[model samples]
Target: MMTHWIKSNSTVFGKYLFVKGLSQKVNSKKFEVGKTVFQSLNGRDLLSFEGYTRNEVYSLLWVATELKNVQQSLRLGKRVGLIWSNPIAKASLTHASQNLESSLCCVHENQLFGSSNNYEMLGRSLASTSDIIFLDVPSWSQSNVEEFAAGSNRPVILISSRDLSPAVVYSELLSFYETYGFLRRVILVYLGPGNNPALNTYFTVFPTIGGHLRYVVDGVIESQASWEKGLRLATKFNTEIKQFEKVDEAIDRAHAISTCSHNLSHMHLKLKDVKEMDLDWTFVQSDSHKGLSVSKDLMKAAGHSLIHEVINNQSWIFQACIAAHTSDYRPIIQPPRFEGVD
Candidate 1:
């Protein structure tokens, strides 16, 4: 009957064969009448198998099951930090950082540091401590790595999206720090003039990736598609703001602006000054500017990728640590933090 079952259900039999291949000691001369049953017996086919003892088979199965559970638990509770250089990268990281925090049931912190323009500030921040840090800056210099490993005992993970040059990517990852630093303030300024007070105020302080300053103004009047895009962006922005320490203000602003009706034209007009402003100097503007020429889909894809990298990279780090330790044991690492110079 078992032979007939194996013949009829080839797929299941194939899986069994694959598992059997994981072992090396299959006795070819055992139980000719019940060969299939003997093969099906656990641990009998494993390379580690000595002789097919029923007790050993049960123990092997229990060990395998326990190991699987341990892996799952490790993945579900890993903490991570994400830091970025540019606005697009920041947005992507923000989207990703939030998702990872939720999926891993871990804490995710976002950071933004000036690179090229203010390498000193960037160095100071990245050189701080973090359990895991993802650098999304376009250009990375050697000094950056030295600073990253300056004070913390945490691991710094670097990520460069395809949009960045390879040279820059290499420089960023190579920059290491002993400790990771946290950004003090991430201000989001809304630069659009609208009858909807809610929209203006809500965008003004919406959190961006890397906890840097984000300025969202009216770029252009929203088409049907643009309106939908804006809604999605707003939804993400709203969700993350709730996780911030001072969430009550964000919640109040969101509630106040929820009832207001506005168009994309108003947003564009409000944000127009952003493009024209000289980014070389620190100047605050309340007007909108010409936004990025990319399509909404491209922007959304970037955001999705950013989130995946943040989550998966942490998982990779955890796996690497596990692999390094032969035992099925995990070490508890503290969250990375920046230690300011005394």
Candidate 2:
């Protein structure tokens, strides 16, 4: 299914640009240097998929895939800090960073505010000392982001849920108003949402990438304007736009489904719902199986084809690795150790 998505846009980048790591496997025994060519995203923030070019998105995915099965330590010597509003989010990311040699300073949302100046000062202080900072708090102050960007031009990742409240969405737009090049270095990664920004970016670049591009917006997390924008884009690209009351109905006809519904309780992708889904069709969910939209059994059934937030989890690792390497600190790849055979 992914191959169909790739083949549809194969000629867009022309012949000169060869995508890396599609068919290759990482060598676990020998140490190998990453031969990633310097790109615009190196040492940059990844706030959202809104501003990324198609090539950049594609390259980033490939690099992330390469690093997914990496046997080496992604232990960057840099100081990476995380400021989270949600405890669940904090837990997931903290667990992912166990291998990394980062001094992860967790700043709760309540600790981030005081006076207007104090808020900006806190952001600056955090940015000044950290090599990479993750912002999972709802909304942001422009002054604070400006200060954070000014300190060292360090990469600031803005994480958003699949279903952002109307108020939070407004705050996000306001905070992203950066004229001082802060956005260029900012990477936007989705923690949850059905209308994923990464998928939107991919389809935007390769509009005619084949297959049906249908959107099921339940208004749980998406704003009126945002979903409309998606429809407008779909129409412009000659893609069919359809609606389904149940997600299973959509899955019945779809080659793949990446579900992230904010309804929480009423909506879920269970084993019964996916009975009609083709075995080869891909399945993805943002969160784990406890009280989430996707059930444990469905996740297990999806198997290797099931992607659990690759754009969110693996992209963060890729960005961290790239940031470390660009700053003259290469990630330490652990050499294979043979205990008895050697």
Candidate 3:
């Protein structure tokens, strides 16, 4: 049956079986067998495993397949390493390991809170291991991706925020390239909207391969203050109460407005910190997680904004900021409490 599945869906089933075979062997190997075992499996090995009805073999196969996909994605002509910091380091590592096509390596606890040289050494060691290195350090200013790239042969990618500013962004990119030629691409992931408009304008001023900019509107949108009162008045008075008439009319007008425009306006407002007092009108609102919430209206608006940004700007690298606060996004995956810098 497994063989038949492989023959029918060779692309999918073959990968599935290969992953299964690797899991069975990983328990015995001390070194990283994930990359190796996946490469070894072929049709013959898969067919042999299928002959045995052992549930263990089946379970191992499932894990192997998933890991294989991740490995292949990471090893596709580019070695990618993810660096994390503080509380977010672990979660980011877990997510990157599962989702990104690259190996996830965290900064050591001792090195994290140590001297600048220690951090530099750690970054160098990590850069040496892969073609692409993602530094999840707290402040991009303190990070030394360029130092690591001095000895590295691959590209170094840094994930940072809007607070870093365009000047900081340019300085880092220039320093990396000048110091170490390996800093081919610097991908900045900006999270705050505090200076998004200015940041957007700044990136447009210097659009180049050396530094690619991406923005993330990282916050939730809540319903307008009037929404609750309007709901209550409508429920209590129905159409008979003249006092609630204006509320009803406002609700109708809000509903008539295109949901996309409303959501987009909401996003801009949230980013710009636009308050109810500033708005002459009101619209329905709800809290969204990292990206748009599951609502069709909000999703469309989010998608439209993303598309517009990408088209207008070159190398706009936008992504959902899973970590809440700036400090929450740490780069060191595992470190003792004492080792963390304030």
Candidate achieving the largest lDDT: 2
Best by TM-score: 2
Question: What are the per-residue Cα lDDT tens digits for candidate 2 across 224-306?
Answer: 33433333333333343344445444445344455553464545556655465444444544333334566667766733224
Mark the regions of model 3 whose C-alpha exceeds 4 Å error after superposition.
Answer: 1-79, 86-102, 108-111, 115-119, 142-145, 151-153, 161-342
> Residue 278 in candidate 3 has what lDDT?
35
- Model 2, runs deviating above 4 Å: 1-38, 73-75, 87-100, 115-120, 139-152, 161-213, 220-225, 228-249, 261-267, 276-280, 287-290, 302-342
Model 3, range 1-342, lDDT digits (tens) per residue?
A: 111111111122321222223211111111111211111111111111112222222222223223323233322223446555433334444454444333455553335544345544655676567545545443434224445445444444444321222212322332222223322122233333323322332233222222223333323212112222222222221211011112223222121111112233323333122223232221221112233422444234431223222211111110111111111222222211111122
Which 10-residue span in candidate 3 carries the lowest summed lDDT? 318-327
User: lDDT per residue, candidate 1, 1-342, as tens digits?
Assistant: 111011111222421221112211212222111111111221111111113232322222223223323344333233444555444434444443343342211222233433434544443454343334455433444345435434333444333322212212111111111112221122222233222222322222222111222223333322222222222333333312221222223222221111112344433221223234312111111101224332234224421112223232333332332222122332233322211122
Off by over 4 Å in 1: 1-78, 86-129, 161-342
Residue 257 C-alpha lDDT in model 3: 12
